[model samples]
Target: MIATAREVKDRVIAALNDHDTEVVMQYFARDAVYVGPVGPAEGREQIAWYFEHLLQAFPDLQITPWCKVPACDPAVSAVSEYVMTGTHLGPLLLPGGSMLEATGQRIAVRGAGLCTIENGLIVSDRDYYDQLELFSQLGLCLPEAVA
Candidate 1:
């Protein structure tokens, strides 16, 4: 039996909550593209690396999906709103090529993700979240701009 997009998304979410990168990778196509706040990760290897880094940064990370939009085509798409809670216990690579060392701060950031699946595997995933919210939670503030 073919797996629907919702099924694949559920499995992926379960794997993520378990902090099992291997299981998560299983649901992504070899050439899957995962686009997040930082950037796009093309291919399974890069995607796996992205997940690994996230788990490392937040070893106790937990994702709670509060809402899921019914996919018009269950076989091809899935979307959901979730809150990710975790402590910054490891280094985080910032967008401007900076590394943020662990501040031991706990954060609960609300976000959403959309995935496109094909043949039981995710081909593309786009994640949206407020980077400023996350940074502020970690005690980071942007420097003032000079006129």
Candidate 2:
């Protein structure tokens, strides 16, 4: 059976919040493109590396999807609203090129995402969140918003 874009994205989001890199990667194609605050990760390996770093930074990362908006022909594209909660316990490079050391701060932030699916596989994913809010929650200083 073929899966819908929403289904694919739902599973992907769940896997992401679980911090299971392999499960999260299954939703994307080998050559998939992922764009987030940090930058673009082109290819599965890069995506895996990104998530590995992310999980390392936030071992308790959790994402809650508030909504899913579907559009485009065949409904292969979707916009999802989400809220995230995590604790900073490891070094992480912010989107703005700043490195943050372990602050052991807990943070919760709201965000949105966009993704395009093809043949039930994620072709592209774009994530948008407020980096400033994250920094503030972490008690860290940032010159600007990371995303």
Candidate 2 colliding pairs: none
lDDT of candidate 1 over 1-147, digit per residue (tens): 879887888899899999999999999999999999999999999999999999999999988989988578878998989999999999999998889999999999999999999888999999888899999999999999999
lDDT for position 68 in model 2: 77
lDDT of 2 at 135: 77
**Distance (Å) between predicted and true CA of 49, model 1?**
0.4
- Candidate 1, lDDT over the whole model: 0.93
Across residues 32-143, which tens digit of lDDT does each residue of candidate 2 receive?
Answer: 9999887899999998998899889899999999887885643688888999888999988975577889899998988898888888899999988887888789887756
TM-score of 2: 0.90
TM-score of each: 0.97, 0.90
What count of clashes does model 1 give?
A: 0
